[model samples]
Target: MANEHYAKFIEEAFVKPIRSVLIIDDDYPTLDEMLELEIIHKNGDLPPKSDKRWHDNPGRIKSVIDGFRQPQRPLLVDIHDGANVDTKGDAKVAAHLHQSDLLVLDYELDKNRPQDGARSIEILRGLITNDHFNLVVIHTSEDLDMVYREVILGLLGATSDELTEGEQEAVNQLIVEYEDVDENALQALRAAVATDQYLHARLHASTYMRTMGQGQQPYSDFCALADEAGWDNGNRRLVLRKLLADAERPLRARMRNASTAGLKWATSGVRWVKAESVFIAFSSKADHDDLFADLQNALEAWNPAPSRLFMAKLRAEMDEYGVVAQTEALERQHALAHWYARLLRSKGDERRWLIAESVLRHSDQLLNTILRRVEVFATELISSEAVAAGDNIEARCQEHFNVDLSKAAPKKKAEREHNAFVSSKSPQGWHLTTGHVFTMNSEHWICLSPACDLVPGQGATRNADFGDRTPFMAVKLHPVPVDGNHDVNSNLYIFVTLDGEVQKFCFNSQGKEAVSPVWRTLYAERRGLLDKDFGFKISAMGAGSRKLVATIHPAQVVAQLRYEYALNLLQKLGVSMTRIGLDFV
Candidate 1:
């Protein structure tokens, strides 16, 4: 019953107008279908022919060809010679041009000369001067030279086979370049599994794509494939057996017992074409400016805070990881920015509040500066410039709030001793050596070894006597502060590893000594930066050095004096106790 109903509906829906089509394809079935469609739409009557009115009538042609839409202005241009054509042939060609809407012309004419097609095309060019919209298809069976092939065929043809041998070989070589991409993916997956850092797989994917000039193809594909594969079989089960086989015993065992069901998505004809394109576009950027602009626009248009926040996160990511090749990045960034600006114009000021919140939240200096620049313009009416400046604020706020302690002085010896250890001697003997004296918090008490001691008697000792064996004559260094205390104890320890060497350290504690060794070949210098608000300079004692000094800024102390102003504002806003906490989070 349903089948009969559907058949009736299809017949009733698709069988009216039948005659208007100028069926050029030499194929009959398509013509029949067109006629059937015409009949369906025209109430069983055919369209009038020779009236020139059907040429203006609007209708869509369903065919493999896409560039052609209207039959009135056919784009296929034939450059056939007029000399070979008699008046009858000329009339037919003219009829095709005037009635059929398109004239597929032969480029060469045999009656004139060997170069008739090219000459014919040139001569007919006068006929379609204003009709540049008409497509001039230069079709030929002859095998032209490479340059001619490229100019005459390759650019015009939609298929790869249209390219010459050299071009095809070049394309094949390009394909070969990506042949090992799957292997690289496997290796990255294996490494990620070993490290238990699944996110690192993304990095590996990105790196591999960049290396092969494929941008993000391999990485995006891996992610999309993995996502499609699902987690039903456990992530470990989803890993390749070959990769796991070389892994340690436990991982190998996991692979052996893995479920094949998790791989259903992998076999579901999954293609990463779109994802690869996106990756390539993103990774090939010349600079982040345009991306930043787009993000700003999106953020301004985003609502509910979370969306804007998400955009901000994306902006941060792009700024950090976007390809640094300035030309590409800049071009992409500008184009993206322009598009985003248009999008924001469509969305209006609701996104502004979100942008403001995001900017204020970051507390960065550069971002704040940019924000301040646009503050005047951000009030009632917003413009693209304001959005841009606001975005810059969000980008730079972290830097704005950063404290610089590079020039600050070290803690006084008396202060360090008070903070780190309760030890003190009376009169002249109670002196602390000046070697980057500062308070650092540690869970364990620090034992000071006598590299060279001044009037040392015994040394320092831990008062807790909990697992501490190092003997001290006067007092032990309390590295961690007690509860409710503002003082910080010195708990700083530096470890150095040299290339191609193993480091061994021996420590004695409580009548027992232990030795530990670590690989030093991977050692590289890592440094920390002080915030812009931090106000201290750090200097450490080197070998044979007796003293180290740090300078402090008195102005910082004065600035902290005003910290209460902000705190009071928070308290008045009812946010101090409820929302504000000492923890960094």
Candidate 2:
């Protein structure tokens, strides 16, 4: 028999509901069905039932949900058999539960049982640990303070208020906002404001940085869970808020985890790609006849410059000056600030890589004149930048805040060569060489011409390794831009930069798309800005493109290309010169 139904959707309109609400109670439709079947005794009441968890009046509760129904959005409902636990609380939530925009979970699964809200908390903690919580409403008749105490201890580890002054203030603000007088869906958001810091720490320590799942390489994304999350407009907002700071608080406790995740997001993928590329190259080498060519390819694939050793040194030297500042690269501003902040952090971290010697040079002056103390020690100065170890919850967890940084900005190229380049620490004689690259205006340019040609009024085979007042012939390299019209591998001559960007000549000289090529002249101690559009030169001679750059300075050399690849590039230059059959008079 068809039961009577209420109007929940418009038949004519095409647009469906935007959000889905799932209400999980102790008992609902099951109890409603029993009442419908006239299972009551003489006085319109059901006899003592076997199930101790059933609601006293489920029909009235169902009516409350029906009252919230609208034709504009979808709604879901479920009933728990029984639930109560201080520690061991588990809920068999379906994958589809991920689709919920607002989860209305009952605080007490069974009123007759203990007020162990762990069942709801367990469900919430799981979703949160995996970053899958929206607006959850713990609807109950009990006082809000009771639930606050339970949730704070369960998730936020309210073990001690050992927070810094600023952190204490931030936490207080978080508490006030969530403790809203109106018992609405957003009230239960306190659990999210101060997310499971321990869970995130564990995720980073045990799972990401250590060994778990793919072992910190690939993205820690729950693609299946995301797919299960509905693709509706409302669901997009739910996912949006996870990253956005409008409804969220910046977590000091989880800074380490955030940084690890960011680094993995940046470096890990490229590392994996390079490893795979090396494997493919090695595999091809076994089948190919040109062992050297295959080996060169494998070597290039295995180690793309700016070398790993350089990064290690850079990190090592930087560590000596300052400790790693654990700040959330993803906090506040628009939804995009998190990503932009991370990119800035990657570059801005160089600021911490200072010259300790510069400060130490004035140590005696500081101790006598500048220091009011009898003797000012280096440890006291170093203490200014020291990071708190363990989960101490210091006041400086996040200090810079929204204020502008008054200090001078970090430079792209460190004035001291050894500060930025690992190779610079080697012999000075090897600084200037063929195929050496110079970084300028945030772009990389390699010396494509021979050392003999770079020297002015030079012999056919002048090999001084490096000469003074010489114009080094060079060309800019850029990552291949895909336009679907030209093949990505337009030319065989390829290059890689210090930041691991795969690059090719600015001009694609492989045939149809080949353009006229030109080279810029670079010289030592010759300071001049490059042409506005140096990459798109239509002639060999250009304004502001030529300068007598004799020897490549230590500060300028970012990396050196392999001999084979450099030779191939030189060969391409010969081919590019003959690209035009004839010239106009």
**Total backbone collisions for each predicted model:** 70, 9
Could you tell me the lDDT of residue 82 within candidate 1?
Answer: 44
CA lDDT, candidate 2, residue 359: 37
- Per-residue alpha-carbon lDDT of candidate 1 for residues 482-528, written as tens digits (9 for 90 to 100): 22223122112111121222111111121111211110111000111
TM-score of each: 0.16, 0.28
Clashes of 2: 9
- Which regions of candidate 1 fall more than 4 Å away from where they truly are? 1-241, 244-369, 374-585
The candidate scoring highest on lDDT is 2
Q: Which candidate is the best by TM-score?
A: 2
Q: Which 10 consecutive residues of model 1 have the lowest summed lDDT?
A: 272-281
